[model samples]
Target: MSTPDNNWEDHWRETLADHKASPPSTMDWGGMEELLEAKVAPLSPIKAPISSLEGKTLKLPGLPWPVWAIAIALVLALGYWLGSHTALGVSQEMNTIPKKTSLADALTPPADTIFDTLFSVGANGELTEEIISIERAIVNRTTAQKSPEINTSLPAGKSPSPSTPVNLNREKLKAGSNDIAPSTTPAVLLSEAKAPTTSPEFFTGIRRPDTPSSAPGLSYDLSSKPTVRPNRGGYVRPLKTLSPPTDRELLEQRIKALSLSEKLVITPLRYKNGHFPAYRPRN
Candidate 1:
């Protein structure tokens, strides 16, 4: 009933129709829609801003370990150099301080000068003169202190006899001075008077009180009160007790009684020592 073209079309359609169309299930359609939404929709900015920011990582080139180590070492070396230079300057300043000399070094005398002075001939003469002068002074003092009264009592016009200690000492000193040194001179005369000797003439002027001499096997009365000896030193009087005044005598004495207001007034309130009185108010 059809043409050849129509017949061929019908034949192909019939063949294709024999393989039935299989439509998708509800679960599969739902799954397909969820996947499409997840792929197409944009994420919320507030919920994942950190993740969005983290995605763009900076990739800068890091320095090498050796370079860092070299830089640190350079800094340390610079610091050490500066510190050491400062310390060196301080040490140099300390070294410039003047050192003090010791006490022993300052006090020590020059050996050569001392030795020269000691060996000099003039120095020896001076020392001998000094010693002889000292000896003469001593001898003169001894003769003056121990001189006999007879020697002192001689007439001023007459020269002392050669036997007197004063004349003998003076002659000896003159001889020594002449023998030793031309620079030496006689010493001054003594001022103190001569001591009196034990001669009978000295005792004739002085009279001593007679004292009783004790005999052997002689005993004195023990019951008798001893006599008070005369005191050569100053005397002191003994302390004495005095009787107290009786209450009847105190009552008999008159008192200048003050008024009640005067007694109550302070002492500073009273006029005294050219000061005007300042009276205190009564309570």
Candidate 2:
């Protein structure tokens, strides 16, 4: 009896013998030869066309040098004109803006006058007296100049002395006063003239005779002083101290207490033993 290895070797030899005894394939070679000839036939003609194109140079129509120069000059002139126009417009805008006057310049008096010099009066009486004296001097001088009769009436030896008060008739004084133009007074003088109230400092520490000692409904006893409790230094300790569980510990506890139904609900859809839903076509 032959072993199983001898049986396998005999079967392989018979298969090899059958393969060697098979006849050669009868496929046609004429079509393949024709295809190869067609592919090689156009190679020589392609080089001839490529070489002919290399020798000739293509010429494009172009503007003359003078025409190009004229175009560049025109562009430069236009750019220069635009730049100058923009600069001129900017300068005109700047010129149109009114110059701002400084605060000090605006507040300052234009010319030094008598009122400007007398601005340092401490008391209202002195300021008023000085203003009145100046007004009287101006009135007298103006009246005397207009009335040539007053000057003629004075003796030739004495021109009117500035110290001597000119006593003119009341009617003449009134008429001359009307003719005299109103002078511009300082703002300080005008404000003081309108309202001559006493300063707040004048009323300091003075109590009114009719004022009540205390408010109508409110009173406090000053005879006795209230006692203050002493402060304890340290903070008070709480009766109970609680430390809440961490997120990880809580999660572990929750996992330990999970029910079968909850586990099934939490399980991934792919892991669950059920057929997937059928695909539905959209309407």
Stretches of candidate 2 off by over 4 Å are 1-62, 95-173, 177-283
| Tens-digit per-residue lDDT, 109-205, candidate 1 | 3322211101101211212111112112111111111111111334465533212233212222222323423123221111011122333222322
Per-residue C-alpha lDDT of model 2 across residues 121-227, encoded as one tens digit per residue: 11121111121121121211211211111112344445332223333322222122234322222222332243213333332322211111111111111112212
lDDT of each: 0.35, 0.36
lDDT of prediction 2: 0.36
> What is candidate 1's TM-score against the reference?
0.16
TM-scores for all predictions: 0.16, 0.19
Whole-model lDDT, candidate 1?
0.35
Q: Which pairs of residues have clashing backbones in candidate 2?
A: none
